[model samples]
Target: MRTAVVFPGLMVCVALLAGCTATAPSRVRVDQAEGGLPNCKTFAWIPTPQQPATLTEQRVKTEVLAKLKEKGYSEAEKADCRVTYVLDVHERPKNKPSVGVGAGGGSGGIGGGIGVSLPIGKRNEQAGTFTIDIVDAAKNAQVWSGSLDATFAKAELNEDEAREIVAKVLERYPDRAPN
Candidate 1:
């Protein structure tokens, strides 16, 4: 009847909606130096010894550079400021019941209960943490830092996702003063 048709249609709609839904980034942690953010218009990227030059790193750097430029900052080899970033990924297991039970009964003097348990495909979760730091060239110390953590169902971060994350993290950056 109408119930049968409506139920399946509703389920389909729900599935489509879930697939199209976008997850929001988690809480961000921001720290400013004791003297507050330094005043600088040019920046250079200084990679850590442990972090090699990789495609992901390059993409993140590009996105961050674009954002900084949009904020009226320029990149320079001997600039007043330096920028560095880090990206980390971790895997976690999803929480789920290990066992399940089912019961059944019939009116014709028949009743029975069944319990079944089986190993389902492992459902692992992944999370990524991104951090950006800015240092004052004259002070030789970090002036500001921002970090964001988000969970994902996949192991790798796509370019779009990485750009979005970088944008979200940089949203906390302080605005530059008028020249």
Candidate 2:
């Protein structure tokens, strides 16, 4: 009896841990114009309409800036390309446990057992997508884009962790700015 109860609890714990262990982003995608990208050595931030300034946004911008610099792009008032990002975060339903109650009787005696179905997969957690776009400032057309989907363990992300995620998404970008 103890083993049955303990085993279910242990399985629950393992499932929760498995969900928490998903730190890397998935569904990464990148798109660029057919003619490749325009020669852009400098970039400027283009405000995303309706996006309020927030800590998460700030962290993303900071990390993106650093990554762009590393890739030979600099921010300036007059730039060859414009940069912007969109973040979409929404709650995702986790696999929930189910409980079933039933009654049974046998000719020898009456017997019953309660059964519970426990979720052994993703627990209730938040998932989100981060997308970055680079547009030609003069032509007002997008040149390149990168995006990643991730399951966030927490509602809020610290700077360091956010940096790592941003870096991963940016990995799809060119190694250096287009000349």
Best lDDT among the predictions, by candidate number: 2
Model-by-model lDDT, in order?
Answer: 0.76, 0.79
TM-score of each: 0.69, 0.67
Model 1: lDDT equals 0.76
Give the alpha carbon lDDT tens digit for every residue of 20-139 in model 2. 756563766999998889888888899666867778878888999999999888899899999998878788867766655444445545444567788786667887888899999999
TM-score of 2: 0.67
Clashing pairs in 2: none
For model 1 the TM-score comes to 0.69
Tell me the tens digit of each residue's lDDT in model 1 across 1-179.
11212245545655665565445647889999998877798989874678566767777889999999988899999989999887788887665433332233344332333344554787778877889999999989999999998875565666787789889888989667779
Q: Supply the global lDDT for candidate 2.
A: 0.79
Once superposed on the true structure, which residue ranges of model 1 sit more than 4 Å away at CA?
Answer: 1-25, 48-52, 95-119, 153-155
